[model samples]
Target: MRKYRHLFRILYLILLLFVFVNLLLGFYGYAFTPLLWNPWLYLGAVTVFCHIWYRFYRNHAPNWQNLVSVLLSLFAMAILVFFIELFFSFDGHDLVTIHSEYYIKEKTIVFQRGSLLDAYDEYHELVNPFVMKKKIKKKVYID
Candidate 1:
């Protein structure tokens, strides 16, 4: 119906606004810790603000009110996963912990780089990720 279409439009606008705000925050790192600042966190803050805006339109736009919140949460979760993978990769050395979706169903982080560490590949994730990540944990990140 005409009403449902309008609801979608309203939801779209809210989503776009949140994206723009998060983009700005992503560009400006927090002062507390230079490297510690993450874009997703900044976006999360803005998303919360947008939630308040959604509350204002709740009565008339109840159907689409919480849609933005759901989407934003999903988006933030994806970003978090990416950051986690990057962190683990650098610390994981040649053995990058990868989530293989093609072959395995369960979440498996594989550390693979070269044949040198191939021998230790089995032990790649056996040890703590921090310790498991060594320059030669198996070998260099690249061959």
Candidate 2:
């Protein structure tokens, strides 16, 4: 167990880095799939795992300085996750001209606008129209 401490630390750091990259990609709208799990849950699990691993496997005594440093790192990661989640929650809208007509010296125009809520509505319509419609309708009203 002692001999594998370095390997475990490296793997742990790699896992954290992977999560960070995923959050960054997700923020940029480039993620293949949205994160399904809660970041707080992940942080909690990591904290518990590290505590057990170091206390038992590494035969290390619990120290306040170490705990504070670990918590600070986790807090920083939590802030990053919070920003990404905030970005996903907000929606942006764009206006598009769908059609225009000129007749008898009069001009007529049509406009089409879209947003993240609209996209979600379309997707939910395809999946389960009845339930999604009610849920989305409530959301729309709230918004």
Candidate 3:
């Protein structure tokens, strides 16, 4: 068991690094957006990581160092979750309600539950709906 301590430490560090990277990508927008949006996935990963840490340390006598490490790990996880929630709060409704539609012109149209309509071109650039409506009208008249 003592020989495996190094392995456990490596695994713990890897998990922490992964969580940090996930948080950074979440802030960067749409990079692992689906993963960030899923609270259950984050919760499960945190739970497993903490459980492994606890199980590993349980075999040894309690020490201040172990306790402090556990506390710091938990604190980091809490901060990560808080920031993610804060990010969601900024556009919570848009995330839950907006749906995207793809058009033949290689445009992606996003519809919000309310009155607003947003369109994005193939390059992911926002296109004014009024301009698109006029273009569609012209195409109809020409045909």
Candidate 4:
């Protein structure tokens, strides 16, 4: 572990630098130009490269601490990518709501904000359309 520790440290630093550079480019509207646009793909490639370095050069299993660090860094990069995508999806809209969990669950990117609600409540009114449209009242039961 001590023999290749310095080399691994350098690789980790390079990974951090790469993510930072790409984040800057992404914010400047150059996300999907050359590389570093797709966070998952780039980060996955970097992880694989790190894994190969550990397997071949170190000739041993990777350290858990190093793996966890790399994964967390990659997660931060993914969040940056999500923010970039969300920024671009808006087109001078009055209201914008981002549902990231839904995007992760379903492989579909929802660009338009709740069209019905946004159209109806343009001034950001806290109106529940369902309650307004429906006449169903809550049953009160006491036991």
lDDT per residue as tens, model 3, 1-143: 65466665776676566557645544544222232334444555576666678676767788899889878888887777666654543342322211222232334232211212432222121233211211111111111
Q: For every model shown, what is its TM-score relative to the native structure?
A: 0.29, 0.32, 0.32, 0.27
Cα lDDT tens digits, model 4, 24-141, are: 6445432211112244344545665565556654554567876786678667766766675555343222112222221211222222333333421111111131001111122222
Candidate 2, residue 4: Cα displacement in angstroms equals 9.9
lDDT by residue (tens digit), candidate 1, 1-143 = 55655765676576566446534543542111111223434444555545555555554555564677667876776676667645543343222233211121122223432334442232222232122222221222433
Off by over 4 Å in 3: 1-46, 58-61, 92-143
Candidate lDDT scores, in order, read 0.40, 0.39, 0.44, 0.40
Regions of candidate 2 where Cα sits further than 4 Å from its true position: 1-62, 91-123, 126-143
Pick the lDDT winner. 3
lDDT measured at residue 96 in model 3 versus the true structure, 0 to 100: 24
Cα lDDT of candidate 3 equals 0.44
Lowest-lDDT window of 10 residues in candidate 4?
A: 125-134
Which candidate wins on TM-score?
3
CA lDDT for candidate 1: 0.40
Candidate achieving higher TM-score, 1 or 3:
3
> Cα lDDT of model 4 overall?
0.40
lDDT of 4 at 1: 68
